[model samples]
Target: MEATKRLDATEQALMLITELSMKHGALMFYQAGGCCEGTQPQCFEKSSFYLRTGDVCIGTIYEFEFWLDKDLFDYWKHMHFTLDVTEGIGAGGFSLETPLGKTFIIKYRLFSELELQNLEAVRINEI
Candidate 1:
């Protein structure tokens, strides 16, 4: 059976990604789990954000890598994440979409038994 992707994007998110990519050159996402901005997904110009060692790259959306903090990944590794967008500035104001009044978000669901069995493996390095 084909492996199921650990990450995906909503249509609105994809459209915004295209716009951000056009304006920012290239883009990437990082979801840090914690208090404050930690709970929200962050979007950045590809080379702008410094990735920590052992960060887990769940997958790609719009050809850009989507990453998660290693500790957060440990907590959420069994779920599938859907990249989304909302109408508001993000908490930290660091994301590219913030200027456009949109913030990247993550909507997740637990993997089904079959999905878990065919889950795509994650990479441990940043792009």
Candidate 2:
């Protein structure tokens, strides 16, 4: 069986990613588990967010890595995530898309048994 990628993005999210990358140079996304960002996916210039040891990178979009907090990854390891964009600002948060009148969100579903077995391995952050 072929590997099933653990993450993906919507068409709108892809278009926005291109725009952000053009302006920001390199981009990365963090699935905000809680706190200030309130579970939204937050986009940042790759250099801005510090990757702590053990953070998990599930996949990428247009060469931009999408990461999750270690604890969050542990909690959702069995699920699949699809990144999406919507027409609103993220409340009190500073994701790059917020200023553009968009908010990044995650739509999730449980993986099938076969898909779970075929899932691409997640990488542990070392940078």
Score candidate 1 by TM-score against the native.
Answer: 0.93
Determine which window of 10 residues in candidate 1 has minimal summed lDDT: 89-98
Clash count, predicted structure 1: 0
Q: What's the residue-level lDDT of 92 in candidate 2?
A: 54
Runs in model 2 lying further than 4 Å from the true structure: none
Task: Show the colliding residue pairs in model 1.
Answer: none
Model 2, 43-107: lDDT tens digits are 99996999888899999998999999887787788988999998977455668988888888899
Every model's Cα RMSD, please?
1.7, 1.3
Instruction: Give a tens-digit lDDT track for model 1, residues 1-127.
Output: 7899999899999999998888888888888866677768889889688889899999999779998888778889998999889898747757788888788888989999989899998999745
Model 2: per-residue Cα lDDT at residue 104: 85
Residue-pair clashes per prediction, in order, are: 0, 0
Work out candidate 1's RMSD over C-alphas.
Answer: 1.7
